[model samples]
Target: MIYISDKAKQKVDALRAEGTLASDYFLRVSVVGGGCSGLSYKLDFDNETKPKDQVFEDKGIKVVTDLKSFLYLCNTTLEFSEGINGKGFYFNNPNAARTCACGDSFAV
Candidate 1:
């Protein structure tokens, strides 16, 4: 299961209200190779769900991931922050073994 914080939910709701995304659009979370730590996280608004996709809903927001990514992201938490030194959504991934300094990438 994946966890979505209230801040994350608010951001998603605001995005949905903009009407720029498809009704089926969801937050896609995935881990890909090629980061300083050997892997990086990718997040985006996506409208497609593949056969092997795993869907999770929390706080009225939907998060989708492929089977492979699911294995690496189970129990992950999505958070959001706002400040002069911090902004945007942050992934608190229990599966990550190491994370980069910028918090944009990680390795399992």
Candidate 2:
């Protein structure tokens, strides 16, 4: 299961409250090929589900990922940072052997 950090939950709440997405929208996370690292993470708000989707909920937020991505993302935590050094959502993934400097991509 993928976990959501407190800061990441807060950020997700703020984004939802901004009224750009539908009320039923959920966070969709996927790993796609191509990046400085071999795999890149993609995140977006979605209301639909695919046949092989895996779902989890933490901190009142629901996150979904496809079957293939789940293999690479299992046991990961989604975190958010707003410090001067960097600011955005990142993953604390135990399965990753290496992550890109930007923290958006990783290789197992």
Candidate 3:
């Protein structure tokens, strides 16, 4: 299962309210190759649900992932951080064996 922090949910809801995303859209999380640590994380808003997709709901927000990606992202946590440096979403993935220096990629 995936968890979405309250901050993350609030951000998503605000984005939707501003018409930045469709009402039917949900968060999509995936792991891909080619990052500094050999694996990278991909996050986006999506409306399509594939046959092998796994759906998770938290605080009324829906998060989706394909079977292959889900294997690498199970038990992951989605969060939002705001600071003088910047404000953005963050992922805490338990399945990651190693993470890149930038913290935007990982390997398992």
Candidate 4:
């Protein structure tokens, strides 16, 4: 099961509270190729679900992902940081062997 940190949940809640995102929207996470570290993470607010999509909920947030992405994201935790390093979402992925300097890509 994928997890979400409290900081991440708070950010998601703030986004929804701002009235920009629709009520039915859910967080969709995916892994795509061609990053500096060989794989990149994608995130979006989606209201549609495809066949065979995997669903999970954590910290009052519903997260969806495709089966193919699940293998690379297993036991991953979604996190948010506002430190001097960078301010954005990040993944604490146990399966990742290495991540890039930008923190937007990883290799397993």
Candidate closest to the true structure, highest lDDT: 4
Candidate ordering by TM-score (highest first): 4, 2, 3, 1
Per-residue accuracy of model 2 over 26-104 as CA lDDT, tens digit each: 9999999988989998888899999889999998889999999999999999999987975599889999999888888
lDDT by residue (1-108, candidate 3, tens digit) is 999998888889999999989889999998788878987888998999988889999999999998988888889999887778644998888998888777898888
Put down candidate 1 lDDT per residue, 1-108, tens digits, no spaces: 989988888878887889877778899998888878887888999988888899998987889999998898899999888779875898999999889898888888
- Say which prediction, candidate 2 or candidate 3, comes out ahead on TM-score: 2
| C-alpha local distance difference test of each model | 0.87, 0.91, 0.88, 0.93
Native-vs-model 1 lDDT?
0.87
Kindly give the stretch of ten consecutive residues in candidate 1 with the minimal lDDT sum: 14-23
Clashing pairs in 2: none
The lDDT ranking, best first, is 4, 2, 3, 1
Comparing 1 with 2 on lDDT, the higher-scoring candidate is 2
Residue 84 of model 1: what lDDT?
92
What's model 2's overall lDDT? 0.91
The alpha-carbon deviation from the true structure for residue 45 of candidate 2, after best TM-score superposition, in angstroms, is 0.5
**What TM-score, over all chains together, does every model reach?**
0.91, 0.94, 0.93, 0.95
Clashing pairs in 1: none
TM-score winner among the candidates? Answer: 4
Q: Which residue pairs of candidate 4 clash?
A: none
